[model samples]
Target: MKHTARPSLLLGIALLMCACSQQPDRPPKEAASPVVVAPAPQTPVDEVQRLLARAARSDPATANDLRLDAATELADRGDTVRARELLASIEGARLEGPQWVRHQVLLARIDIEDAAPATALARLDNPAMQTESAGITRATQVDLALVRADALQALNRPVESARERSLIQAWMSDEQQRRANARAILATLSQVDMGELGHEIGSATSDDWRGWLELASIWRDLRPGPNAQRAELQNWQQRNALIPSLEPAYRELAPEILERIKQPRRIALLLPLGGAAGAGAHAVLHGYLAEHYRQLQAGESAPPFAVIDTTSTEGGFPAAYNAAVSDGAELVIGPLLKEDLQAFAGNLELQVPTIALNFDNENPLALPKLYQFGLDAGDEVAQLAREADNRNLHRTLLLADASPRARRQVEDFNKQWRARNGVVLDTLYLGDLNDYRVQLERTLLVAQSRERSDMLARTLGFKFESEPRRRQDLDFAVLLADPVAARSVRPLLSFLYAGDLPLWATSESNAAVAGNRSDQDLEALRFIDMPWFSSAEATLRRSIQAAGYSGAIERLVALGVDASRLQSRVGLLTWLNEAGLGGATGELSLDTQGRIHRRGQWYVFADGTASPEKARPETPDPSSTEGGTAWQPQEQAPQTRDAPPRITP
Candidate 1:
């Protein structure tokens, strides 16, 4: 279904690169003739920066274009305030379609990532973006499409995210068409003059392994069925092959690199063995301890685990530390809080690989050997984005509240989505929960139109696309805000649900309502979440309850336990990962940096209440538990006749 590439695409940049030097497509309209190219030894910046300095030399028009480009660069480097200053210098009214549209896209993306989706949406709300206006020209459509997609994913609509995928899919029908379409989209975007994006994709065949792998990952991640699967493997293989170049220090030096990775001999367990987190700590300990017994049962030596109370007085820490280390400990798990870490930091020597729940990135004085491995926000988003990609979701919009936390989430998600070549529609911000309906109406309707939908109507064939597809709006969104806000957004959900838009969520949506559940708008809405325990059968439940008993009665009765350990870990990790949209606890796999990659299972709400669509397996027979171990006979005790002997001898 992909339309063949137009003559305009062939005659564009690729052709220009083949012929080394080309005359100006048009003289600088500002009438400043002869732009200079610097000498050989000059830095790359020297040429680009020099012309930009005298941008205003000829006139305001040249100055505005140069200002836009400069502003975009600043924005790319995570400097919004400075970028905004440059943007203010440009007169928005003076710029034309593609240039003007590109400026709006960048400005809006910055606002969105900074948690001002409201402002970002305003910038991209140009009428030309919605329709093929006589004046807009085709060159700007793709940019508008990409930015609009970002807007949707931010809003928490995965099904609608799929629709955005459908939109991109229509641009290219088959596998080859999709890759070419992606290459085309990247090619066009490269010209938009966004600072980093320009360098994001150089010649794909060149030495730019990161760019190539990134693009290949996106393309293969999006395509579905057999062909897409094959493409995905090939692309991943290509990426793996180029890992050495992409991470020079990572792959090159042999033994030196190997030595840097400290393999723990014996890990010291520091956790709340006697407080609120005690049950959870113990439940985790059951797993860690079970790992030891299981290893020993398999004829492998069990690593000794030296457990300690993570919550300890300042005076107790040094003694406990010395004790654990003296016992051949090569690592430490907790001492969970910041106070304990700071108190012990100065006195501690680098004797073990410490796994703190807290990261020293925020605390520069953080302990030397400590590697933090708690729930990180970026790790969750990275995982969630991968899941979204696996589901073939092409377009993602991000909607976030205005806050530093929300903005950071936006930045991480943006980087991930861009890396995947997925489109971010509009990341809208919420000022007041009351304005939910009004705000969403503008977002959903303004971007979608009758004319384009009518033309693309027969084009997009998914069942969900019946009316919504014909409308140029996004079908899914990522609401990167909290649950309280989402609960308030029930009315907004009304707007979306009426349109049959499926709303997706991060872990936040599962939070208990502060007030009434009666008014909760999100209950019926479907989203993906991570459960700490993948197997939620009755047997799994009984096994976990038995593991956390504090009383004989609780231990004797499989039905009772002080707290629900399995649910707690799953629920907490679900929330934490949602803080990243990362997957489950048991599978909580991450890269060396502790970013979650392969974790969690995705659940959709098929019925009214939240339930797992897939059923979990029951516990195996005790005889068969250890990789089909032989059923052993139970030992019998000898009986005594004490009462008979006391009768009268």
Candidate 2:
């Protein structure tokens, strides 16, 4: 059969096969039209505002939630007006549980922000709002409590504020939050009057919370000694044995309580006992012993003490300090001269607590257990600036002697004055006490008055009687000079028609001795000094005199008395700067650097005698207003007196 087919037939069959194989395949199905999705709707308002608008169109309750959130943001930005408007829209809206509480809280917050704490307080006190409800979450309750506390604080109700703050612990679970709340409560309590605090604690209902607050209040007033404080704490613990909640706080405070009770058994006094510094040292010793005896007479436990004579030894302060330490001295107080103190503080490996009787102008190394206390004029100058600041006397005219010591005082005053944002109108240095009119006229700008007088005389073509007037720009004048210079300068100020201006001076303006003819000239001059110099307490003066201390040494005697008493209280003073101890020197407080500063009562010379100025009025509570900021004014810086001229042996 293959042989019978012709070539044309075979060729046709091959062509047919090729045509069938060349047929095209079907095309792939077009990708399914991509599913189109509309983009999210964008609104002009923020998310919260848009949500509120949408919810308002449908669910009013949801609308209120959004509005509350939006209002909270507005309030935070201090936009009270708009926040109030948003809050008003939710008025009468049916809300419950957290929503209701949140609404109330926000309303109160608005009141607080607007400085209407009383109004806020009234709203928060509603009994219906205070009751726990199924809708109120623990967090919402906490917010309500915090808002209430804020309102109470704003209203100046510290007791109420503290009580409200204590309630927060019942709702708060976070430890850090609880600690923060506790600090706030304690700070509020701190502002309360001590007597009032005691009264509040005493009147509180018997409860674990009240007991905790009482414990804190008692601890604050307990004796500074660790032993005394611990005893008090233990007594409180026994009384509050059932208060398991306070266990953590007590445990935390235990170590500090123990440390505060520890005290040195013996103290060593190092002073120059020979040469020019000898008399001053003796006066100090006399005062120290006088206080020791006084304390003994009062049946108080006085620590054993020893005196080492640094001037008597050839090795000076270093040998004496080493000898005293080797003799079992637990504390050292001495090296009266500034140079000796600097040398001792610098060279010695301090093993025990020390209170240097003088301060170094140089920035010396700060050693642990080292304290500096002295009769430096810098203290008085700083106090003068504070008094002026307290009196609202922003502009000051400084009149001081030209001596280096006086200049140093002026420099210190300027430093403190500048710190308080005071303006120094002028600083006049009086070279000669005999003639201060020229200096006064120049400093007070009285030359302008003289020029005016000359102009009037020239205008009228005749001389006329006239007194030059001081510049009115100055609010107060600070005079730093000795009694001799002050006596001469005071009358001159009056002669120059400046008697109307308030004049403030340091202790140096008044002669410590009574019945001075110069006292007449010191009339109306306000001054500040230690109680030992200005006090009318006969017993104190007699005790000092009985110690054979008099004249300039009398002040040194008082310093010694204060120094001896301060040894026991150094720990207390160091820990709490506001805890003032009334000593012979004045109200004493220890600065952060262990420098003791004194606050003297202001005194004014009147009717031929110096009398204490009236006590200043109590500062009004700043929280009384809607404004939450406390407005406490800065008080006088504690001052130290200047050293009298060294008496020769």
Candidate 3:
């Protein structure tokens, strides 16, 4: 057992942010369903006085508090003109037990707020301004100190940030006063990093409505949280958002924290089971479930996988998931279609951890405790980037495609790659790639021209000698275009800059034809992909009847079975560290950040059809075997008909 000599922030830091301020449930005014005051919007001032007078006669204890609160809010909203009158109207009244002190300070703050910094500092020095020493309300001191701090900081006083921090430090040193520090600090810091702050804000322990009200208020104070103020948060918010310094440090300790949060202990898998998705889902279910079960057989506790019929049942994910929870599955998996997950995301409460088999229609969207793992074209590009990373290919050139998704994929890859260690030289979006090779050759020759280099140099305030034989600084060329693009660009790029750069492609570049195989197009596009299947799963192949191929051949069609081989490759592996039988898709595990950290079978497009490490690597033949079509994809059907037609809810 590890010795707990002191609270190790390094270990799972059991931190729960307490936000006392909550915003009212008011939708935006410009939304289709805007909450317009049809008549007109006006401050309810007279109403406040009416309520106050009634309360004063009935419950003076609450009356003073209400009046004082209204005044403070008006002041905060910049109605300082009239807010001063409201505060003055209530300043003479006796408030309940501890609220009297808050009133005085809030009243003084209006003056403190209006006065010059020097005047505010002088006011703080007044004996009358200080809370009584005998038995001061705890908040009084804090309120005074914070006001003074804000005032000083506003006017460029000598030690505002430090002095405020020091006073808070002193307050926290006192055991009794320490209770609210976490809340206060969290409130202030949340303003800076709203997204970051939200990751940890769950329900608080207090049932008191006031606590919730305060959290609402604090949350509304969306200025900047302390975390946002930190040098690290500031840096990450600008760049490298995927890897916040504090988050990584915190994430490393997440397992322990996860161990403590009981609900997400369950996971859900949503895969299409029948119809067009059956064959793929079946194989995916085979590899992923097999791997997970294999781990369980090895004594690891695997989360339960509830194989719901996501194919047929168009409308029952919610009810079915509730049934799963009733039956003991903590999380869910399988809804191999986007519509089903969308349905669940819209209507169903996230009862358990859900790992979606298909991505949402919104590109690059995240679901609450919901992650998608599917075989999209982009996954292939990411795999190539990973391989490039391993090879230390720090500089890259991108040949683009017209597909919107492809554009975003390349864009994300460049953004992430640069954040990692590389730069994308250029991405050329083109209309037709039929003459890709010739075009690439000419483009490279021109871009590499001494004259062109000299012009570019002049733009950058520098000069390069007009030497034709000199090399270019670019390292790798990424083919975001499809197999068709590969057929042209590969030979052309190589013909121009053959020895200097390595060309990359998604598994789509697999162009191996069966009989009339040609080795021309595979000249330089060497890349990596998630393994969908390999030659080793003997019995697994026998299980798949039609499109009968040997286990020796790699298969990616099976990915749709469970979710899709693509989903298993990224999402499933990300949720768990288990291995899959991704022969063609490339088998390996992934982390939540979508990093392929483990080694998977790499199939270089030699002669085409994916050739595993042991298989003979042939030169890429444009018509030999299509990288994607050469290996028959799993032909599966959807799960069922319990679901309804898809429409935006």
Task: Report each candidate's C-alpha RMSD, comma-separated, in the order given.
Answer: 21.8, 25.0, 21.2
Residue-level lDDT of model 1, residues 152-208, one tens digit each, is 445533222222322443333345544444343332321121112223444334343
lDDT of 2 by residue, 1-649 (tens): 0011000001111111222222222122232121111222344666546555566575555665666777776666666677777666665566645576577678778888777766776665554443423456666667667777787676667677767666555456776666566555555665454445556777788575676566556544422333445666777767766655454445544334345544578889999988899999988888888767766775566778888889887788988888889989888888788778777556677778888887776765466788888886777788788667656689988888778888888889989999989998888777765455676767777778778878877887866555566788888888898887777656666666666667789887777776766577776778887767544345766878865666666878888877776676567555433444455666666676767777665777764477666532432222111111112223533544642222111
Question: Candidate 1: where is the Cα deviation over 4 Å?
Answer: 1-267, 272-303, 316-319, 338-347, 361-371, 387-395, 400-407, 418-425, 428-433, 446-471, 481-491, 494-499, 511-528, 536-541, 545-598, 608-649
Which wins on TM-score, candidate 1 or candidate 3? 3
| Candidate 1 structure lDDT | 0.44
Local distance difference test values of all predictions, in order: 0.44, 0.65, 0.45
Candidate of highest lDDT: 2
What is the Cα-based lDDT of residue 44 in candidate 1? 71
Report how far residue 453 has shifted in candidate 3, in Å: 17
Model 3 worst lDDT window (10 residues): 4-13
TM-score of each: 0.41, 0.61, 0.41
Point out where model 2 deviates above 4 Å.
1-263, 433-435, 445-469, 534-538, 615-649
